[model samples]
Target: MVCVPIALIVVVVLIDVLAPPHIHLGPLLVAAPAITASFAGPRLTGLVAALAVAAQALIAVLRDRDELFSANHQAQIAALVLVGASLVVFCVVRERHARELSQVRYVSETAQRVVLRPLPHRIGPLRVASLYLAAEAEAQIGGDLYAVARTGHGTRLIVGDVRGKGMTAVGDAALLLGAFRGAAHRQADLVELVTYLDGSVCWDLAEPGETDRSGETFITATVLDIPDDDDRVDMIDCGHPPPILVRGGRARVINAYQAAPPLGLGDLARPRYHVDSFGFEAGDLLLLYTDGITEARDSAGAFYPLAERIDGWTEDDPAAFLHRLRRDLLDHVGGHMGDDAAMIAIGRAPASRP
Candidate 1:
């Protein structure tokens, strides 16, 4: 539908070029974007149309003083009409888009509430915090995802990255979330949960149909379980970045004690998972994230430093810490994200005095 008007603009331009002695192309030209004004987003379409009309109007006004029958008067009328029509279209389309955007946001927010429920402010004497950036500004869902649930075993957490974006990625993500929520509760160990997720992915792969495109959907994930607040934090690195542990105001990456392949396509070979244990002490911060954070690059292609970036910024608030991280990440990436990002922070408060 939006392409139709763009085509109309091209035709109008061609017609004017071919037969400029007759046929008015200016109004049609102005109306072309005005047609897309209802779809290209109100702000963008309106701005573009305004600039286009104003530029031509000024050109016509300037040239009229020196020319005979310069088509200036008629152009001015058409420009003004288009501008006015664009404004009206902008208002109506803006309202419609606002409503649609609101609905998408609501759905996304609901999905977040259901699938990415925030960890409690305090989880077993530790402060729980997190941040999430969906790849699409208009869509609530993306390929990166994370979830934390206090299971019978302990605080179970899962962070995974799906392939691609848009509707297809969202569908895959939904499958993963359902698997995690079910298996997280049913399975006692994180490794078994990994197996369940692998099976689920393989199942979903078949649904997308066999494509000889030499492409398959796979997810890089990390699963963690905290047995207690002061004990070691158990983590399974299934291809995610090694989480960072901050203690005494120092941040350090916790390398996987053992490495394993990413989830999905595991039937190609037997998958092995190494559970790494990290020292969890009072006043220590544990940050887990998807690849989006580490992969965020500046205009110069300098990748973001996941572990070393926020060493000295000390705020006792977990949410604030993650929020600041998100802002810094966007600033580094020029306010755009090429991939979905998800993160969760678990910090142990200073131990109660003995």
Candidate 2:
């Protein structure tokens, strides 16, 4: 990049000296700073500007005695100086903005790490893999959240989507995750754990100005329990998208017989959360995802066919299966997601000791 401006200086100087005197090429030096803007920073831009001005002075002095101080030469030198100074200012401003953006990205990354800790590769007997894709690249993590914990009853998990976007929703996700973690071990029952989470969310929502929305903001969540010795899984769906069960290279949604109202909306309607049972034998995988995957759309406005795409991916390994699904989903949406997407893949070990 430094070589680019230096080469431009050399070429422009040679052309100015070798061309016919009737045509002045000294004005071409302005390009040095403009070109430097693309690849180099303010310090290099200033150096290029200095070199250009020096080259202009050398040309003026070496060409002819009268041309050195003539009004035309003075005007050319003034224009060059003005433009070079302006480019230096441009570089300075650009550098400041670059530093500011870097700082903002640093803060965002730290927040994401603290709020959405990475999922472990193995939790109890199930191999686990999780992925999070934020709609805005700058906002590294959003309202979508997932959590896994071992308890007296089984390995408990929750995948949820909050009501809104931005920092407020992220705060809500953190709160819910904290509540689930605290309650999962002590409650010992799926309904009791979910009831604790519901109380926590209702308490948070009842606080005025804690959330941005005025009325009826809620969280849609799915809670799952996989006993270490059992071949079945239990789920409590709170108005969230159903988990998909993959077995024998086939994928099918496991919709609950009756879904309870979303958390924080239980008071509006009498809440009756039911535990839906499903076969989750060895060599089977359960895929839980937020609406972002199903709601993702292509250029033609067609929603992403997540179930159809996963049908062809027979990889039972949680990591590989999720990696393929993420790639295919991005390809379907042309690499732009409109909302935060999160997925958790839990594959039951094929062989377990009795």
In terms of TM-score, which candidate is strongest?
2
In candidate 2, which residue pairs clash? none
Distance from true location, Cα of 85 in model 2, Å: 2.8
Candidate 2 ranges with C-alpha deviation above 4 Å: 62-65, 69-72, 134-136, 208-216, 295-303, 330-339, 351-354
lDDT (10s digit) by residue, model 1, range 102-167: 888787667655656555677666688877776654564667777766676467878888777655
* Backbone clashes, each candidate: 0, 0
lDDT of 2 by residue, 1-354 (tens): 778878988988888888887877888888887798777777778788888888888888867666688887788778877887888888789889878878876776677667778999988789999988767545445678889888865799999998877677778889999998888888868898888898888888778766444345789999999999889999999999999999988999999999988887765675877999999988898899999999999989999987888885679999999999989889988998977799999998876557
Cα shift from native, residue 318, model 1 (Å): 2.0
Winner by lDDT: 2
Question: What TM value does model 1 have?
Answer: 0.69
